[model samples]
Target: MQRVLIRSIFKLSNQHATKPYLLQQHQQEARINSISCYYCVYSSKRGQQENDGWGKSKRHFISLLTLGIGLGGIGTAYILAKEVSALEKTATNNDTHENWHKERRTDLPTYKQEQITKHDTLEKRVWVTYGVGVYDITEFIPKHPGSDKIMLGAGSAIDPFWHIYQQHNNKEILTLLESYRIGNLDKADEVSTEDMGSPWGNEPKRHPLLKPASERPFNAEPPLSLLAENFLTPNEFFYVRNHLPVPVIDAEGYELDIEIEESDTTRSFTLEEIKKLPKVTVTAAVMCGGNRRSEMTEVKPVKGLSWSGGAVGNAKWSGAKLRDILLAMGVESDEKRHVIFEGCDLDPTSHPYGASIPLSKAMDERGDVILAYEMNGETINRDHGFPLRAIVPGTVGARNVKWLSRIIISDSESSSHWQQNDYKGFSPSTDWDTVDFTKSPAIQAMPVTSAICSPSQGEKVQIVNGCINVKGYAWSGGGRRIVRVDLTSDGGETWHVAELEQEDLPDGRHYGWSLWSAKLPVPSGCKQVEIWSKAVDSAYNTQPESFKYTWNLRGVLSNAYHRVKVEIE
Candidate 1:
């Protein structure tokens, strides 16, 4: 019986050898059960023991010796399991790039510029340089989001391209690029900064009041208080969301090319000719897809610019109606087709920034889509896409392509990097590693959102007659009107309706934002109070209560409840 019990214990330990922690627990339980069984058997047979003290003592000694052997076997199994687990963990760490710092190679080979140039083609294998590092990007070519755009840097340095596409300057992309590092560029062949002239050298001057989010591409927005002050945001105070350096366009020489994909025919329109067309005015709000992203980041870290609520502004845009232009050009609109807009803003490789909108929206009489040339009754400034820009009302700012250079009526959307890859939302769980941009559709109409413009996050408010006044803006995409704005001072325990000041426009045609203000009674004896505001659109869509539920990896469409904690005196 002792020999059988020892064999069973060894078998159980071997079965769970790979799971050290689990095996230890199971082994301990088995030992207790086996000892209990031995005691039961010994007690039952005790009456049958010989009537001699020496015989009983010998039997007890054997039982203890057997028990010791079982315990010894368990200890040995535990030690072996522990060693195996450690070895497995070491092997995993060796395979992952997380430990790259510990095992990074230092003896990389060096290659000259001429050598890199030789491997530019697929047949020769594509190679590119960044700074002093030479990388073999042959395998990454097919997987690149920009597709053939990456091939432009095949045999040369990609520093210029990366300078234009600053989004690639992130850690994830840099680390992924480093993984394909084959060698270092020879010191003598390194490109000088002088040779790579700044593309942003001719950038137009911007208003100091417009807070800068980025300098190179020149993204800026006005202060929230200043933004809420004007129903028609001043041309200079309007938010600027440029993705590329301002293009130096000659107003007299500027030409817009219109192409029909189905007919393979093209037509050109000069700035004067575009102005001669019937002019129309649109009062709308252009909000960046990443507006209020800073709030989302508080819930969980996300990619893209950390934009505040200021990345939005309402303006009166004047331009030639796109629908009328298309009809006059003898181009028939189809629901299945798309109106692709290309901007003159180009990267180092001359790839223009582009985006597309549904033909249905472009052709809709109420859509108000236009080829805008004037902002706030003044000639459009260079920073705001002077000469020509696409005014895509009720759509995300990304679709409103700036510096309009070309328009294409196509069955498919634009093949630009921004349209195909960027400005898309994803599940909070979908991180960079597992993100598949193709799976998610590009964001178009934005969600309902609102923010407190006055009495900023930590501002002190004077209670007038036991009530604190709150002011903010509320808006929704798809021409949805702000039906109601709700304010709560006691964490949504009670709600107060805010008076909405909106344009008197037809339902579903309310393209502008609704400025709302409310006076809430302060909780008795509360020194600090948090005020939360949310808006309901005409479509009955409302802002989410918490950012956690609406969080996305790219941080787009972050329209959660706006909360501000203020001190009451």
Candidate 2:
């Protein structure tokens, strides 16, 4: 039987070598594994077959069956191990090859020529460029959060679409993209003529969640959801209401000029010299006077940047007290006088950005006003006035001058347009053509205001467990604490008290906003819920019941009870 098996094997091999049978597509890879296993079993059972052909056949059959199972299992294990090792080696080599190409690509030609190198179709060779960096996003494309949206720019410049989908402007997102960078973009590529006239041409990147009110003067506010997350807003997420392009300043050369009209002395203090003065810290909320202007516009057309309810933030400011500085300058406590602040940021006319508060507000011992260089524990960023700025704790945001370059103590108020004409309140009967700027005073402390951040305006709310969650921030200017927040889903027909994220202060001096949240039961057959929130401050001040009576031409001081509509789907 052994001799026969050997002769049969030899004959089969010769026949196969001369005219080999092709394997089916699926069996191609496993054909060798099967052939090797048969050879291994037959070789191990060679000596077991003995005696006459019939007896040998019986013995060989039994032996072959027993050894085939054991030897086949061992052969399969060996093949699997070999295949895995080969795969690992191939992956290592591919990674090393990719790294080498990345290093080489870094030294390649400028972005002008390289911008055309975007090739995203191939599995392991996809490439794209954003800003000044070229990246190999082949592996990342499949795992991208935005999925196929990224594929639209697979082999092309993604900047145009990135501008529209602003979420890509985030620092964490940029850093993640940088990890895949293969090269730097060319520095010589001129600005595309198509985008030259765009208002956002040279604007600094902002947090994508912010709603833009204007692109030229650069005003924006964070989403209300983010505004109420922390007691002190992160500097990056803070509201920006710039009247001009943010000034580029050098801290080493930066100076704060203090001009005293009474003393006829002008003193200039460098950033370092200003730091040497006694430091003080204060926590306050800076809210734009135009906050919620859009709500007022619903009642009547108003003239101003179309701001929403997010143009406000609370932060910790650290700097030298303005009162101390005034005392050092020997300023007289006169109510008729004013303290003016001028920012380095200049408008198109080259006029310095300026505003002023009454001398009493500036000199009040408890006002907590300061020449702030730090916001929320870090040096201010360029967007929020780098090097130095001013913080007026309980005043309108316009009075908190950014990039503070000069401070003037004078008997007259700031003659800047922002002070004399803009940022002042007007009567509801006043029209743009019939307005008298002199009749109204500049807005100082804000009115008690609250806005529902969740269940956004015109949002569809799912009835989860038969209830909906409502959340918002409420605060009053002049350090007035929010004592109560009332919420209603039936258009003020009934009200439920919202629980504050942090309990209200016993001292009734909470300057920052209170994050109020509550879950209200949905009425059985209600197809729509008109959600409303109104806050009561420590002074018993509450937002007006209607905006019709509060509407003004400039849209300042629009503190109406906030309303949002939600459809029950």
Residues 162-185, candidate 2: write the lDDT tens digits: 322232344333434444555554
* Candidate 2: 10-residue stretch with minimal lDDT: 59-68
Worst 10 residues of 1 by lDDT: 59-68
User: What are the runs in model 2 whose C-alpha is more than 4 Å off?
Assistant: 1-203, 464-466, 502-509
Q: Model 2, residue 272: displacement in angstroms?
A: 1.2
Per-residue lDDT tens digits of candidate 1, residues 1-569?
11111011112122112222211223223221111111011111112211111121111100000001111100100000111122223222444433332232344666666667667787678777776777665644453344355566677766544444444444344444554566666665564333333445566788889888666556778887776677788888888887666666667667888888888888888889989999999999999998998899999866556788999989889999999988887877677999999876654444567889999999899999999999989998988888789999899999998888789999998877788877888887876446677898988899999998888888898999889988999999999999999999999899999998899998778999999888888788899999999999998999999999889866899899999999987
TM-score of each: 0.77, 0.64
All predictions: root-mean-square deviation over Cα?
24.3, 28.7
